[model samples]
Target: MDVTFGFLLLFVATFLVAGLVKGVTGMGLPTVAVGMLGSAVSPVTAAAMLVIPSLVTNVWQLLNGPSLGALLRRLWPMMLAILLGTVASTALLVEGDSRWSGMALGGALVAYAAYALLSPSTSVPGRWERPLAPLVGLVTGVLTGATGVFTLPAVPWLQSLRLPRDVLVQALGLAFTVSTVALALGLGRLGEFRLGQLGWSTAGIVPALVGMALGQAVRSRISQQRFRQFFLAFLILLGLELAIRALL
Candidate 1:
């Protein structure tokens, strides 16, 4: 794709908004960026663009949290499963029909948002976590390979673990960081990710970081519950638009 001025503007704007969402909520950067950009670019291209920014932000999120050693010890199975699942689905990364991918992306967003809105208090038992973690990771990896979004069962499953707030945030960062690297590897293997796109993807870091800072500032002053409700509602609208466009 040509690096037209308008495209650059849109790219920056998209990441800025996406970064803000992640800053406030501890996740959603890739989902929001890819969902918005998928309308204008192919899902493959959008996923490629998100590779660097997502990696950087998520790595930061991962490192800043508590007990990295413990988290990895407990979550390694799931992380490995995510990698294997992504590798298994690498072909889908390049061969997917854009329309179908769009619908898939939209469906993912809608499902995640709806679950967050309606689900009552829930928890995954300790024994169940041992058995269920890999399953969730594998499903999340396949979905990430196909749609460039990694928040479906992964996020919900994480929430159900009932970690403390900070630990949960760190866990999300670790999962997303793994997913981003796995997706990048899949894209690289298929030759869909190219050097030319790096310039734009790299440039996105500035806006994304700026947006995160602003969002963190706002997060301190506002009701997170209210903001989250608003965010989910916006996601529903965006998801519906993407789905409708795909069907048309």
Candidate 2:
């Protein structure tokens, strides 16, 4: 939109920091960036800027791991529901007023922050997966369509699948990749997906990869324990600000 060098710098730095978080903790790229950037830009703009970087990083995440065929076969039902819900809901979101989408994004941030702060390791029997996953996908898709954030029940539900840790991480990447692509299609249909934004989004990938390298190098020294809690607190504050901004 504005296309200022200063804003581009801010964008790069934000992704650098966000990518560091993802490298260290296996997530938070979009959440951290969107939460902070949303303070300066509209939620929709933040989402737009996130499009390509999100897609690329998540694709790397998905492909770097093994057993893609199995994860896809097993997870297809929920994934399909996610795509369906995204298409159905995002068309409305893209065409209607944006304030509601802004407010939705803010609320998603707040809810995610609070959940990360409070939730403990949880478990559900595998028996529940079939019945529960589609519901989770539907809700996650609707939220992603409206707000461009997609954690909440999806992450927890994935965890509940009792997948190995590596596979779980890859699963997240796969799901997020699907979400980002589906979102891009919706944005394109709405005529909000511009080539310039994609260019900037592509440029952001470099800083993100650099940050990922830095994070991996320093992972042993960083106290990932406290880092997460602090991140959640920061997000809570930012999310509140966004929600307030949306209301006003």
Candidate 3:
């Protein structure tokens, strides 16, 4: 594909916005980018585009935060679950119809948002927390690989746990890393990964990193509640887009 100046310009602007979200929140990179670009490109391409940028920004998060050992120990089960889900879903990619897929994705997001708003329980049960985290990882991995959507079914569960803010951010960064890696591998195997595609995708990280630098400065000023509200609102918009696309 010719690298149109139009696509490049859109890519730069979208990456900057996505980067700001990731820079501050540590996990919304793909979400924000995909949501914006999904309208302009096929979702598959959008998913592939994220691979390079996500890898770049996530490396920054891991370096700045440096909790790999702890995160690995804590999230291994979830990682494995995600891997399994990705493997199982690989075959479905070719047959996957985006409109129907969008419906499924939209339903999951809507349900998640509702749960986040209305769940009676504030935290996972002690017994469930250990097992459930990975289960969330599994769902997130499947959705991410199949649709380039990272509506991790488990994020709300994690949020409800209310770990220290930094730990939560570290955990999210790790989750993004795992999902992004799996999606890249699966897409590569399926031949959706390409050098030219990646070249453009790589350009997105510049804005993402800029967002991160600015995010650090703002993180301390924003209350967690405000961040949560903003994230939920974003999810709702994404979900609505998917749902409406499905209907159309």
lDDT of 1: 0.79
lDDT of 3: 0.73
After best superposition, candidate 1 residue 230: deviation in angstroms? 6.7
Q: How high is each candidate's TM-score?
A: 0.87, 0.79, 0.87
- Model 3, residue 235: what's the lDDT? 65
Q: lDDT of candidate 2 vs native?
A: 0.73
lDDT of 2 by residue, 103-200 (tens): 66567767876775677444667788888878889888887787676665576577556566557767988898888888888888888788877887
lDDT of all predictions: 0.79, 0.73, 0.73
> Which portions of model 3 show Cα errors greater than 4 Å?
118-121
Using lDDT as the yardstick, the better of models 1 and 3 is 1
Q: Which stretches of candidate 2 lie over 4 Å from their true place?
A: 95-121, 216-248
RMSD of each: 2.6, 3.6, 2.4
